[model samples]
Target: MRAERRSGSLMAAPYAAFLLIFAAYPILFALVLVFLKWDLVTTPVFAGADNMRMLATDTRFWRAVANTFVFLSIHLPLQVASALMLALALNRPLAFRSFWRAAFFLPVVISGAVVAILWSNLYATDVGLINGVLVRIGLRPVPWLTDPSTAMPAIAAMVTWKNVGFYVIIYLAGLQYIPRSCKEAIEIEGASTWQRFRFLTLPLLLPQTILVVTLSTINGFQLFIEPYVMTGGGPLRRTYSIVLYLYTNAFAYQKMGYAATIGVALALIIGSVVFIQRRVIGNAEAL
Candidate 1:
């Protein structure tokens, strides 16, 4: 018994050490850094809650939070509906099913930086593919990233388009788990297609719905690469995300302490929002 226990401990020790070095230490140090000032060039000096205080009152930080919520409001529903619809459409027996699935998922496997760059051209106001289409349809070209009102939503839409393929795969996998008997029974009970989906298919996909909401919400909060590469958090700072703001603080402003504070606050906000969303969704499921 002693030898077995010792052997298990030896086997797990490397992973435990790795976690301590990579995860635990960084987390602890980040928390500590939130109270101290350091720019990597100057000596670290303890500021003691100043960073937190500044972050709490910073209007720009609040604006970033508000912008994130705006992005999510548009991104989340669009993502869920688009993914679910595509999943539903592809669920039935269709020609070249694997090919269709692969095509849809191709964008998801692409790098975010590449996606952002690709979309930048597609969204350019004067020479964009979107603008060209609008002009061909006799409509005025609209500035996607150049207008404050449209910039964030444009980014949200691009993100949705980029990630919908991944979530489609998710919903597709969820659709498979739904019992065929349940679907057949609903149809036998004289339920319309909409009713069947509303009652049976939708309810059964609760876990996937929860996953989509949580993952998309976290992604919305962490939006940096898209805005950074595309808009540079520009067009009146409409697309400025929290992560972008944090990066600006750390790199440009040399406010490492405040950046860590933003990180901590972001983590807390994400955790709380996801918790509330789960509770709400769970209660809805129960009802």
Candidate 2:
């Protein structure tokens, strides 16, 4: 038994070493850096808890947090609903099925920078494809990225469009696990289609829904490239995100300590929110 245990440890040694080097060291150093000021050029100086204090009271940080919530509020429901609907539609036999799936998923595989640049032109108020259609229909052109009220929502919509395909794949996979017998049983009991979905389909898909919510929430928190390339976190900073603010602190302001503090805060906030979301969803499922 001891020899077997030793062999198992030997087999896992490479992964353990990699974890220490790549994961453990960075985490430990980040915590250390949260108490020291460094610009990646000069000697680091101890700043104590100033970074934590500033992070707590920073209006920009709070604003970014609020903006992220706005993005998530719009993105999460739209993503889940759109993906689920598409998965249901494609669940049936259809012509060019692979083509449709590939088209939807193509954007997800493209680089974020490329997507942002493409969307910048697509969202241009005067000559945008979207606004052009609106104008042709006798409706006024709407400011998508220029107006603060619409900017975040517009980005959220775009993100949903980009990522919905991935979640559709997820939901499609979940749909397969649902026992056909259960669905047939419900149908034979005089249950309507909506009732069948509500009672049979939706409940079984809870795990996928939870995964979608958690991943989208994390993605919302880490939003930087989309806003950075498209709006530069502007038009009243409506699209600013926590990671963007963290980058500004470290790269632009030379505030390593504060950046690390922001990183820590972001991790805490994400953990708390995900935990609460799971609890709430679990409770609803129990009901």
Candidate 3:
């Protein structure tokens, strides 16, 4: 048994070392860097609480936070609704179901950068596919990525399109666990479709809904690629994101301490929001 234990430890050593190097080191270094100023070209100097103070007072950082909230407002609902609807459709008996599922999931496999770049052209005002369709349908072309009013919403729509397939698979898995006997019994009682779904299906799917909410919330907070590639924080900084702000601080401004501070703040914010969401949803599920 001691020899077996020794072998097991030896086998796990590489993965443990990998985590220490990649994950633990970076995290600890980031925490330490939050209190020090380093411009990469110069020696690190102690900044004490200055980075934290600046982060708290930074208007651009706060604006990016607000922008994320705006994005979540649009993205969360669209993601849930479209994914649920698609899952429901796919749940029913259909021909070519596997093909359909694969088609929906195809976009999820594509790189976010690629998706953003592809959508940029699709959202172009003058010569875009979406605008061409709108014009053909006797509608005025809308500035999707360029206008302050429409930029975030357009990105939200694109994000929804990209990730809906993944959530659909989640909902579909949850749907399977729902007992058919309950569905049949509800139908026998003359429960209409909506009634059955509201009382039975929805209740059983609570766990999945909670997962969707939590994940979508985190994804919403970590939003960088879409805004970075499609909008570049855009027309009036309408689509600015916290991660992008962090990247700007670290790379563009060379303010490592401030960037690390922003990173710490972002981590805290994500944790707090997800905690609140889980508490709310877990309580709801209990009730």
Candidate 4:
């Protein structure tokens, strides 16, 4: 047993070292930087809690947080509904099953920047595909990326489309584990399709649903690449996100200390939000 333990430790040492170097070290350094003002070229100076004070009154930062909430409002439900529906369809035996699955998940494996750029063109006003169809039908072309009201929603829709495949895979895995006996019993009871789904399928998949919500919420909070590529957080900053603001402070504005503060604050906020979500989802006794 001792020899086996030694061998296991040896096998795990590389991963432990990797995490210490890549994850643990960076996080610890960022926490230290939160109290020190230092541009990459300057000697670090202790700033104490100045960064935290500035963050408290930072209206722009609060706006970015609000913008993220708006994005989540749209992205979360759309992601869950679309992914669940697609997964249900895919679970059934269908023609070209592998092809359909591949097509859905293709965007998940593709570069996010590439997906953002592609959607940018598609959402373009004048010659873009959707607007062009609307124009042909005598409707005015909508400024999707350039309008404050539409910009975040457009990005939300794009993100949902891009990631729906990943969540669909999650739901699919959950579907596979549902006992065949439960399905057979539901059919024996002559439950209608929707009733069976509501009473049996959805309730049984509660764990997967909770997982989908928590993951998408985290992804929503970490939104950066899509808005950066598509709108540059423009159209009156409607698409500005928390992570975008953090990136701007660190790289664009050269406020490393404040950026670290934002990073720390973001971590806390994510933990709090995810905790509340799990509580709410956990208390769902039915439906």
Candidate 5:
């Protein structure tokens, strides 16, 4: 028994070391950095709560927060609706189903910067695919990335398109576990197609829905690459993200302590939003 215990510890040593170095140490150092002032040049000063105090009244920080929420507002519903609809469609028998599945999932594995760059050209004001279509149809071209009103929406749409396939797989897995007997029973109850789906399929997928909500919320807060590459958080900062602001503080301004503060705040915000989502969705599921 003692020999077996020793072997088990040996097997776990690498994982323990990984957590210590990559996860635990970073978190601890970030927490410590939250109360100090350091620019990576001078000695770190203990500023007590000044970092927190400044963050509380920072207009630009608040604007970035609001911009993230705006992105989420457009993203969440589109992500869920598109993924669910595609999942439902793909769950049925179709020609080349496997190929279609692979095609949809291709973008998810692509590099984020590559995806952003591809979409940037596609969203260009003139000499772009979308605008070319509009002009061919004799309609006015809309400035997708250059207009403040449309820049974030365009990014949200791109993100939804890129990530929807992942959620489709999740919903597909959930669909499989749904007991065949329940589906048959619903059909035999004189339930119409819409009635069966509404009364059975939608309700049975609540857990998957909740999972999607939580994950997409976290991704929404961590948005950086898309805005960074496409708009550079431009068109009047409409697409500025919290992560981008944190990067600017740390690298551009050399405000490591303030950057750490922003990082901590972002973590807190992600946690709080995800917690609220789980509670709300879980309660709805309970009902």
Candidate 6:
């Protein structure tokens, strides 16, 4: 038994070492950095709680947080509705089912940077495809990325379009777990389609719904590439995201300690929001 235990430890050694060197070390160092000042070139100096104090008073940081909320306001409902609709449509036996699924999921496999760049041109005010269509319809061109009011919403729509397929697949898998017997039983009860969906399909899909909300919320908070590539957090910083601000602190300002503080704060925010969401959803499910 001792020999077997030793062998098991040996087998796990590499993974344990990797975690220590990569994950654990970075996390611990980041926490430490929050209490110090370092510019990557100079020696680190202890800063006590200065970083945290500044973070609390920083309007720019709060603005980024607010921008994230704006993004989520448009993103979450659109993601759930579109993904659920596509999943339902694909769940039915249809021609080119595989093709349709693949086409939807193709954006998921594509690089986010590429998607942002592609959408940038599509969102361009004058010659853009969307605006061109509007012009042809006797409407004025709308500045998607350049306008403060429309910038974050435009990004949210693009993100939903890019990621809806991934959630469709999630819902599709959940749909498969729904027992055919249960569905047939509902049909025999002569329940209308909407009645069956509300009473049956939706409740059974609760877990997947929770997962989608959690993941998309996290992704919305961590948004960087889309705003970075498309708007550069412009149009009055309406598209500025928390992660983008953190990046600016670290690289642009060389404020490593403050950047680390931002990182810690962001983690806390994400955890709190997700926890509240899960609790609210779980309670609703129980009811």
Runs in model 1 deviating more than 4 A are 10-14
- Model 5: lDDT to the true structure: 0.93
Order of candidates by lDDT, top first? 6, 4, 3, 5, 1, 2
- Each prediction's whole-model lDDT (CA): 0.93, 0.91, 0.94, 0.95, 0.93, 0.96
Cα TM-score of candidate 3: 0.98
lDDT of 1 at 6: 100
Pairs that collide, model 4: none
Q: For candidate 2, what is the lDDT? A: 0.91
- Clashes (N, CA, C under 3 Å) per candidate: 0, 0, 0, 0, 0, 0
TM-score of each model, in listed order = 0.96, 0.95, 0.98, 0.97, 0.98, 0.96
Worst 10 residues of 5 by lDDT: 277-286
Those runs of model 6 whose alpha carbons end farther than 4 Å from true positions after fitting are none
Please identify model 4 stretches exceeding 4 Å from their true place. Answer: 1-3
lDDT of 3: 0.94
| Residue 154 alpha-carbon offset, candidate 5, angstroms | 0.6
Question: How do the residues 1-24 of candidate 6 rate in per-residue lDDT, one tens digit apiece?
Answer: 999999999999999999999999
Distance (Å) between predicted and true CA of 184, model 6?
1.2
For model 2, the run of ten residues with the poorest summed lDDT:
49-58
- After superposing all C-alphas onto the true structure, candidate 6 shows an RMSD in angstroms of 1.2
* Ten-residue stretch with the least lDDT total in model 1: 231-240
What TM-score should be assigned to candidate 1? 0.96
